[model samples]
Target: MGEQNPLCVNVSTTNSTTEILSRYDMINWVNDCLHTHYTKIEELCSGAAYCQFMNMMFPGCVNLRKVKVKANLEHEYIQNFKVLQASFKKVGVDKNIPVDQMIKGRFQDNFEFVQWFKKFFDANYVGQKYDPMEARESTIIWGGTPPGPSRIGHNNKVSASRLVHATKPTTRKASGLDSKHIGAATQTAGGAEGGGSQKLEDLTSQVSKLKTKVDGLEKERDFYYGKLRDIEVLCQEREQRNGKSVGTEKILEILYATKEGFAVPEDHVEEGAAV
Candidate 1:
């Protein structure tokens, strides 16, 4: 849903015409958003233009209680909030991110939009930073290698310790605050981690349900196998009673093995003739 509707999701094109959004860029932002905002997305951050677009599509996030977000959306199209919202509002799409993806969507136990905002402004809205929540609970940071035409340095590191690092701009210069408000973000990250654990438990429950289904299928397979074997045995028994190759041949072989050496043929030995 980037740029406009009917998006070519997963489409491959390095041509200039294609508007590319990479998943790697979204990891920090998605984590930060969740850490910063425990409230429903209806009360999410301030991006007026995006707000304008989203309000148009999902007029009421109140009624739409559940949503399912894809990994790609969270890690790729996240910067395009309106587009993400519109996709969710589209009649067929769900608005919540599933819990299975929630843990994976984040960078740390605690992170949020406020943290992401700091990073974003610091990074100067670099193409290396963009994200969106695709579902009620799920978030996928696209870990796959950069696609062709994709930016090369989003995942590079400043040092061995930092897999990737983005130095945020100073609050004194931008917001006139005494220090970076990132600590406030850090405080909220704790709650995000806790929420993440709960979501993981939900996924565990789903796995248990799937295991139950697999066990039931195995039982059914055993039952059907027993029925087939019984049918084969019945067929053999009937063949023995009647006459047929294999079954009948087996009976003849047994009889021949048991017979005394050269008994006169029953037909050739005439009993007392009924003259």
Candidate 2:
């Protein structure tokens, strides 16, 4: 069978939204905030919408030109996130962007982060009527191409030549791996060196893939842990105010059992499962 779509996954954990906002509610909130047409929460992974969000809240904080609005590759996504993170730090927003998990477009992780961001937005937004499209288009780069010369201005406009030069990779002069030495080495041990280089590359690729998988798993674990912690806090608050009922007791038992190294009673487990 094929792998499940991340966008299609209906996350069933305790919602991070205070008002128990549904997926559609969060999606709509994002769309409304950024003036976007995003249908799925996974579309936020590009980080473009987020940059505009920051720009909306804190004007001139994010350089929209740096944000890749149509990021398709992982590296492009990273660049967009880097721009977002820099904007956050610049504006003293003490939040970490989970770039690794977000780039993978996981529903749960992305949704949780977006939930937190929405709360932050509510707290920080100062009832300003900001045009997202204007802000984005003011410095937007389209389809990996820099703006034309006619668009250059004294303000936020970047020259086309500068943009092209920035994107172009610099050529580094090799010390020992010069073409003359390479030819001599190739004549002596060409096949052996080529095979060794291929093997090294393969091993590096495998290591990178494994590292990414580990990062995703760690992010998932932290995401679930945070949800449980939120639930625990809510339960504690409820118990203090209204007192615990059967449902609270069973849920608390499961949560406490996780840390106390004790087994939950089978009957309580079954009851919680049924609930």
Candidate 3:
């Protein structure tokens, strides 16, 4: 199975140690060719670059599991794992193994990767197959959604204070509600002039009503007093025409002695005309 992988050269024995040494020579040659090729695959896995060279190399030929180094300059070593066994044989050397059992391992599943302990492990294959966001969670790196072409995740909630502003009303805490009564005299009541004018208007209306009532009473009193003055004038005119009045009496004649007999006036008048 290791021979079919092609990352390592297939070697067969000639029953002579000379042919065994020939296999060693083939292994060294193959390691040199694969050296750069292995590095190429690694750069693709670690970068955003897609694996454009996957077609040229054998599938999974960083040996898939990296424990078998594809290129080791130290020993001139490379790993050759079997890929397929065909009864339809070719000129190359290989081992016979079933495809099903060999293909069982996956490039996904971090638990399997930890167990693998292979260098140059599948990154892009591992990351895409499992979510990169999910992979990041295994380590200290924050797991998050990949950005779009705009380099921003859809549905990401980031409240940027610089870009936005505080929505609450911008009032100073020192400015408290003014509950003071304002009507009598204050700037808030449109100054003292406004309040005083309204009060003066009300008082003027009351004073006008009181003056109207006083005028009506004075008119009635004047009418009664004029009638009393007319009555007193009529009585005085009647008193001037009579002696004193209709019931007037003479006090002097009555006091004298001439009035002792029937009437002193009758004596005086009758003596003159004694007959």
Return the top candidate by lDDT.
Answer: 2
Tell me which residue pairs clash in candidate 3: 1-82
Model 2 bad stretches (over 4 Å): 1-17, 138-275
Poorest stretch of ten by lDDT in candidate 1: 160-169
lDDT of 1 by residue, 1-275 (tens): 46445311222223353333232234334346433221112112222223222322334431212222222233232443444445445533323422222323232211233233233233323233222343222333212211111111233112211211111111123232212343433444456575776655565565556556654554454344333323333444465568466764554343223234633334322221221
Over 4 Å off in model 1, which ranges?
A: 1-192, 245-275
lDDT of 3 by residue, 1-275 (tens): 35553333333223342222232233232223222221111111121111111211223322222222222121211111221121113323243332222222111221122222111122112322222222222221111111111111122112111111111111111122211222222433354375677765665565556556654554454344333323333344355576355432232112211322332222322221221
lDDT of 2 by residue, 115-186 (tens): 777777776777898877787775332212111121222331232223323222211222222444445444
Model 3 lDDT-worst window of ten: 142-151
TM-score to true structure, per model: 0.19, 0.45, 0.20
Candidate 2: lDDT over CA atoms? Answer: 0.59
By TM-score, the best candidate is: 2
